[model samples]
Target: MQTIETVVNVTSERQITVQLPPDIPTGEYDIVIVINESVKSEKLAGEKKIKTLKFSAYPVGLVADNFTFRREDLYDR
Candidate 1:
């Protein structure tokens, strides 16, 4: 078994072409492909601008005015 690592560009038709080394004789063999997600995300980052979300506090009156948060309240008594 041997491993060859190389980067290839994907065509508009969603196809990839890889050239094997001449030393590797022509024969039927099991092939495995792995796509790196980080590389894909990096490429997409340049093509689209993601909107940044602004954090804001929720409006009042959702909970009782007298309600208070306590660590003990989370436990099953």
Candidate 2:
């Protein structure tokens, strides 16, 4: 018994192709598939939103060159 999990995009209305591992010898095996259209759409929307985000400078007084403290300076001497 072996289990293989992978993601495949649908190229057509009701067709999806999955490539099996070569190690698994050719033979009949149980297959199962689960679809989550809502999740996939949400992921795409989130990616788009992230891409449109605006970039700005850091907070006041936190800019570069202000990081003078060393890693060992956080503890008591």
Top-lDDT structure, candidate number: 1
When summed lDDT is taken over every stretch of 10 residues in candidate 1, the lowest stretch is 59-68
- Report lDDT per candidate: 0.85, 0.75
Segments in model 1 whose C-alpha atoms lie over 4 Å from true places: 56-77
What lDDT tens digits, residue by residue, belong to model 2 across residues 9-75? 8776878988888898887778777786877888889887645667897768634665656767556
Candidate 2 lDDT for residue 54? 75
- Write down the TM-score of every candidate: 0.56, 0.46
lDDT of 1 by residue, 1-77 (tens): 88998887999998999999899999899999998888888888888887789999876663776666776765767
Candidate 2 differs from the real structure by a C-alpha RMSD in angstroms, to one decimal, of 7.2
Q: Which parts of model 2 are misplaced by more than 4 Å?
A: 37-39, 47-77
Q: How close is candidate 2 to the true structure, as a TM-score?
A: 0.46
The candidate maximizing TM-score is 1
lDDT of 2: 0.75
Error of 2 at 10 (Å): 0.7
